[model samples]
Target: MNDKANNIKRQIAITRRDELGHPPLHLDNNSRLCLNCNRAINDEINIIEADPACLRLNVLTQSASQTCVICNAQEDIGRLTIHCRVNVFIEVNIYIPDNVRSCEHHLDENGMFHNRLLPGLRFINRPYLIKGPQLQLFLQHLRNVSANKVKGIDDKNLTEDEFKCIAPVSKQQFEELFTYCDPVYYNGKLRQIKRKDLLMFLCKMRQGLSDDFLKIIFDYHSRQTVSSVAACVRTSLLERFVPTNIGLQSITRENFIEQHVTEFANELYNPRPAEPKVIAVIDSTYAYVHKSKSFRVLRQSYCFHKNRHLLKPTLIVAPDGFILMICGPYFSDAGNNDANIIREEFERDANTLREWFQNQDIVLVDRGYRDAVPLLQHLGIDHRMPAFLQRGHRQLSTEDGNESRIITKNRWVVEARNGHLKSVFKFLGQTMNLQHAQNLSGFYRIAGAILNRYHPLINMQDVNAEFARQMLQRSTVPNAIQARVEVDNLRLRNGQWRRLYGEDVPDFPLLDLGYLKDLTMGIYQINLAPSYIQDKLIRENDKELQLDEHINEPGFLRIRLFSRFRNVVKHQIFIAYTANEMENIDNNADNNPISGYYCTCQSGARSLGTCAHVASVLWYLGFARHQPNIKYPDTSLLDTTLDAAYRQPADIAQNINVDVIDIN
Candidate 1:
């Protein structure tokens, strides 16, 4: 009963296969036919293992595997195991060419043919059997003739080496088998499969072959092919990687100071002027190189200023060793004096400068800047020059050494700038011949700024006069304020004199004294007879000095401008003369010695400082009295009480009436 039940179940399963359009029952082992066409079936093939019974079987198992009844062709769908199956097939009517020798060479020895005798005879690599009678017959009428039209028998057996190369050895075998071969992707179908594409890929990876390198490696035909490959890589690197990140171009003052200044300052003493505690020391240097010998040299002009031949650039430096301005790289033969160049640059921005110079901002300079006074006057700037111990005035009074100390101590900045520039840019320090001069000029002007921006500044003096003065007055200052003191002092010194003269209470109208007898034929001031004026002034001075030989050393009188003020006060001249000698000299008469006086300005001193001709008249007319300290002190100090025998005091505060004059 149980056996009968099993037989029924098997019949039912077979019935289901027929219903699902499965392969025909009782199919031939070697001969085949399509389910749809019965006439000697031959066409392309497909192997599908979808049903439970066929799913675990290899496709090429012929009848044991599922067959495509529509084509009668077979396909192997199996996993690779590093080996191919040995097929000791019934080596039927296939001919092996004598030239194609094999490990197992004999075939059809018993006529029925031992398949094992023909190595790879059961299934070997496919090769066309075009001359075979069976294949020739079907190919003539085959549809899709280019496809796998089964027409010939491939009877080949696998040798031990060939079998192992095709399939990996395993300890056990199972009914289910896998057919693994080429992958879905052509480039990397099987990892170890050495296809043409695989070899090329490996060449790229191993050698890091760039397009050009690869082209030469493989002997590619043209530059266009290699260039196209390289351009893609280059474009990718530039746009996708390099451009989106930080690069080398972003340098600015604020960015630089923030990123580097603190770290740099900590490394050294590189505090900048922008920082509160730092000072900048600025100076100019020049660059020189060989040029044609026929270059033009600067012409010889008497530079009353330096009194020496020089090709110079005006380098204004800070007290802290920072360069403030490298004003020029001017040419010597360019017909520009130092003063002239300075004036031109000053006027170029006069209004801005005038606005900058307030009460205490100082400019330090050298004596070549005598014209500094006028230029700065227009700008409202104050300037200073070091005491030329030769000019011989009372800037440093002998009373105390304070004035001398102040002038000498602060004057080194300008000198240092001049010396520093000459030393570093040695060619510029000396005279230039001509050819390389202009290039050197540009170098000198620009090099300092470059040096200052890059090099270390050192030995900066802490005193910034403007900063200190403004601090006292409670004022704010600009970061790069170039309140050059000496340049301004020169102007202020002159301007103050002009103002002093302009503001003075008219002691006499600075008038047409040309009408006076000695002043005839020329515009003159407070003119008087030279001889008569001389007698009167000298006679008066003799009342005290007695115009003795002791007092009358050289000339009869000394004359200078009146109104004691900056540079010099006014054009109005004053004279103190001598008549009687204090001692009886053999050359002149006795106790009636003529009195003598002199002035420090141009009106006296043989017209170097001042002249005697003008001096005499100024003294004779008592214009000398207008000046408080002349040859003799003014007698205004004498009170009536001191003079009265009865001790009656002269009136004090006589001008108590309210009449105010505005000095400004």
Candidate 2:
């Protein structure tokens, strides 16, 4: 009877659970649904059972979605929904803990939030997580953006300032050059480097920077890489850029005459009726070099003029400073003098200079090219060089002096142009290293090309041709006063003149600085005259002056001044002055002076204009002397004579023909 009662109790419990519409606690593996709501659970949601027989579903989902079905069912059935087994996964791994006790939360190391919690779930701190593939894609996108911002050589994205730092030419000009040197390849690989970058590298090299320094600045991997790239680019530039920009073929003879030949050059150089068709100024410039290991090379590279090892290159430029051609980085030995190098350029079968040059083409040169004069004459070329000083004469004759000055005035452009090349490209200024010494010709050629393409005209504008013409005409005139004084032996006639010093001549004329500049034709000599005067004053206290009362006309005074080039050497300068008589003369007037002037200095003897020595005397007498207690800025007091003596030990000086004089 008791067993029958227990069986009835178990049956009643089963029947009550069935009447409540509850399903079995365990289901097949294919079933994934909440027991309370009989709804499908999301695969992403987590489900947890409280016990094997009683299912306690913990559905974890995003907060943006509706609450889990189990929670809704529990709420509808009038049970507490707060204890329902469901968790929302909103704001996961979003906020990090603040160890500094600040009011705000901070981002994690990966720039993301940490310690994210769901609405019904417990708060937890964890590492910020991102899918591997998503993170990789995002990083790659950032890399692409950064690369796009960085401009390559060929790109037109660089600013003008940035572009100019690399290349002397403009972007448009570089593009044109790019088309010419476009197909540069190295080691069978198409050059990935941009033309602009290559050009910038070349310019940096020319600027005299070390390969190591360039590598750091340019983001190159190694110094070797920078050197290699620079070499390749330089080779390309020499092959294409130099031929088109620098060579003789670049400009036709007609164009050269019409555009480049200045009117000042024509007037000054072509004064005679038998003038040549073209006037070219020629000179040799030296590049310093290291002492070679080989005895033959060391002997060959020694330059007596520079007192060092050097390479000499002949530069032939137009009178306007346009470089026409460059010939040979000839060895600086005795046999390879400037004259010989120039002769080779003309006579050598390999050279085109002889074929291109026509008869009667005037070439202006300095005294260094005197040996080449006969060769030039043989080729029917008229070469004009400065006259040499006579051995016994204190100064050149007035005619010879005047002729020399004319040649110098026109030939100065070539010297200035050579200076410009050295100034712009510092690589040329410094002694080239052994590695680059082998390719000196190529370097020189490239430098010439760069200057021709980018540098400004050496003579910025044509000089006043009319003024030049008048000067040229006046240079031919003989100084009557100078001739008379010499013929009459006026300097020796001491009784005919009163001796005067700076202190005795208080009536010295007053003149303006502008007047001095006009007299000298340029400020360089005038600016230098004060230093020369200061040097003379500091070194020699008792400067002598003699006034010739016999030759004194109404407004003229003849004075003899003692001048010295060095301590042991003394010379006399004869001055014929016509005092300014106009009471209200403007200070700016060019003729405001002791108007008529001449000196015994080589250049002053020329009727072309006054020399620095003559200008200095005139300035001192007219302006500087009249200023009471005026002070001049002290210049370098380094006595080169003492410096040289100090460099040598005592006994060696006696063996060398060194004549020691007491400077004190």
Top lDDT model: 2
Residue-level lDDT of model 1, residues 1-664, one tens digit each, is 1245334333433443564457856523343334533221111111111222322111121222332222233453222111112122212322322122221112121122232333323221112223366445434434333243242111124354442232221112100111111222212221211122222222332233444555554344454544333333222223322222112222333433444332222212221334422222222223222333433532333233545444546665544444545555554443565566677666775574334334333455555566656765655444654344446553222211222223333345556655555554343444544443544444353334323443455443333434233222321211110122223342233322322221122222221122221221111223222333323333333221111111322222222333323533532232322332222223323431222223333322221111334434433333332333323222234343255444322222221112332111
Model 2 backbone overlap count: 3
lDDT of 2 by residue, 1-664 (tens): 1245334333433443464456744333443323522222211122212222332222222221222212332122221111111111223422211111111112212122222312333222212233477446545645654565353343366687777666656667777766655434565543433454466565664577787777666656578777767766777777778888776777877677777777777766665533436778899999899988999999999988778999988899987788888888899988998788888887773356775666877899888788888889998888898888899886777788878877877788889878877876777888888788888788888778878887777663325577677767777878776776678776577665655565555545556666665566555566555555654554443343334445354334554333545555434455654455543346555664444556666665766666777776766666665554434443324432356444322232122222222111
Q: What is the lDDT of candidate 1?
A: 0.33
lDDT score for residue 387 of model 1: 40
TM-scores for every predicted model: 0.26, 0.67
Candidate 2: stretches off by over 4 Å: 1-180, 187-196, 271-276, 349-351, 460-462, 488-507, 541-565, 581-595, 623-664
